[model samples]
Target: MSRGFTLLELLITILVIGALMVWAVPSYSSVSEKIKMERLAKELSGFVLMAKSEAVMRRERLWIHIVMSGATNSSGDWSLELTDRDTQGVGNRLLHLSGKPFDGITLSNTYTSDQISFDETHGRPKSGRISFHPINASTDLLEMRTYHRSAIVRVCSPNSALYLNYERC
Candidate 1:
């Protein structure tokens, strides 16, 4: 016999590899999505905290408008703007961030108003919650809650069972 692999052996190896891939792809995709959601929550929280600090340091009102809208699993755009109203009453944009990272995600907030304002004296917005949910999945939900005195970015699952690296709400 020649020192070469036979057709039968090659076919078996390919089928095993294919089977493994079929089994592993969904798990990998789910994990990837969870990571992305976590990152988004953390980044948003950081931005809000930064705005709060800026308002306190500058002693001026800073308004943060977080807007997200679109059908789930569809291409959509979201934006966050930090503005300050000058003496002339013209709004000055301090920092603006916009992106379409929420391709298959849906976002909702519990705040009464869409605009959150941090006064010069207090570096906090009214207590509320911002939640992120995947369109097709039910388990990887994440939320961030802010308190009266501080802006805390808590990435927790609303589900009863814990998922990924997040704690249960």
Candidate 2:
């Protein structure tokens, strides 16, 4: 004579739902972290491309400089800064790009130089490669040597490539 679920049936349903949530919570957190890292990597790659393009379009020297926050010689957050070659052809201009904290994403150590430029003649990176490692949720360090996944942008002349996985960077 019951139109709806009995007490036992309702309790069983709640238990099953609770079990699923418990199982899914960890997986969902992991997926979200991966997505945030991936997105931040893509954005960094785009920034490099934009600088290269701008250099050629403006017929001038445009460069990108990476600065690491330091406290008593201890490195912290890494910030990307833009610099333009001055009238004397020196990279003395500084401009900070503004953006929100991109989903707690952080950059890892992959780039070798603190500053890099694009050749105005070829619209290519002057030299060297830049890398972005997604900080592990487990480890807060910017260096991902201990982490497995990352993203890279390589400036290898005509062979230059972007959107590369960190392992290959």
Candidate 3:
């Protein structure tokens, strides 16, 4: 016989490769979503920290805004801005951190209150929570039909006493 794989051996090898692909594909997709969620959370945290730092360093009230809007699997839009001196004044666009990583992700604030302001004196936040949901589906317990994805990343600042990484938020 020639020094070549037999038909039976080749078939078995192909079967094995196919089986592995079947198992790997779904896992890869789920893991990708998880990674996206983690990355978005980190970016948001960094943005918050940056605001805190700027406010402290400049020693002036720094008001910032973040806007997130996306309906479905469509990529969402998030832009950061610097508000005029007046607390409720219109914000001038500072930077738009391309939210492509979080395109299909849903970002909603649990508190939905203040426009995130850091005091020049202490660099403290107004105390709130921002929740990231991968899909628009709702969770079982919350039952609000707002959050769908089980994988979530939450940025929480329970009180104004929060001092970035230095203190509990």
Candidate 4:
């Protein structure tokens, strides 16, 4: 005959809710970070592909530049720029992770040159290959750590294939 829960019942409910939140918050954050990383990677890769297509279609050279710099207002956010090799006009661009530096995230060693250029024939750089490695230089993979993010854009020779890897700090 009680319209409201007793004090003990209310306390038990509150404790259960708090425990669930404690267990779920971290997992949710991790998942969200993963999604952001994956999305950034995909977008970067797509831009590379588009650049390749443009080169072949226009019968001219094209280049995509990756700049690892601090976020918009922050001091360590990573960003990228894509330009036409001929006109050098802005084609595609992105600033990583929306300027939100996740805790414990940092970019390790990066092995790419300042710019990646594609020829009119949609071929990879005839001069040499650019490799990105973690700061340790033990691997070609870039490590994204707290307050930082790392990105890797790899284009196959002849520009027939392209791959991108992005990680959140």
- Candidate 1 or 4, higher TM-score? 1
Sort the candidates on TM-score, descending order: 1, 3, 2, 4
Model 3 CA lDDT for position 118: 64
- In candidate 1, which residue pairs get closer than 3 Å at backbone N, Cα or C atoms, i.e. clash? none
lDDT per residue as tens, model 1, 1-169: 6799999999999999999999999999877777767767777778788888899999988877765563223243777678885222248878876647756666777766466777788787667777777667755677777777765546677885666667787
Backbone clash total, candidate 2: 1
Residue by residue across 1-169, what tens digits does model 4's lDDT show?
7598899999999999999999999888666655544443445456655655666777776665645553111233554455664232355442222323322233322324545566776434323232222222223232221110112334322222322333322
- Model 3 RMSD, rounded to 1 decimal: 8.6
Better of 2 and 4 by lDDT: 2
Model 2 regions lying over 4 Å from their true place: 67-79, 85-101, 109-113, 126-129, 137-169
Error (Å) of candidate 1 at residue 137 is: 2.1
lDDT of 3 by residue, 27-133 (tens): 88767766766676667767767766777787877665655553223356655455534344354544345666677666655434335666777666665555555
Best by lDDT: 1
Best by TM-score: 1
True lDDT of residue 101, candidate 4? 39
Better of 1 and 4 by lDDT: 1
Order of candidate numbers by lDDT, starting with the best: 1, 3, 2, 4
> In candidate 2, what are the lDDT values of residues 16-39, reduced to their tens digit?
999999999989977776665565
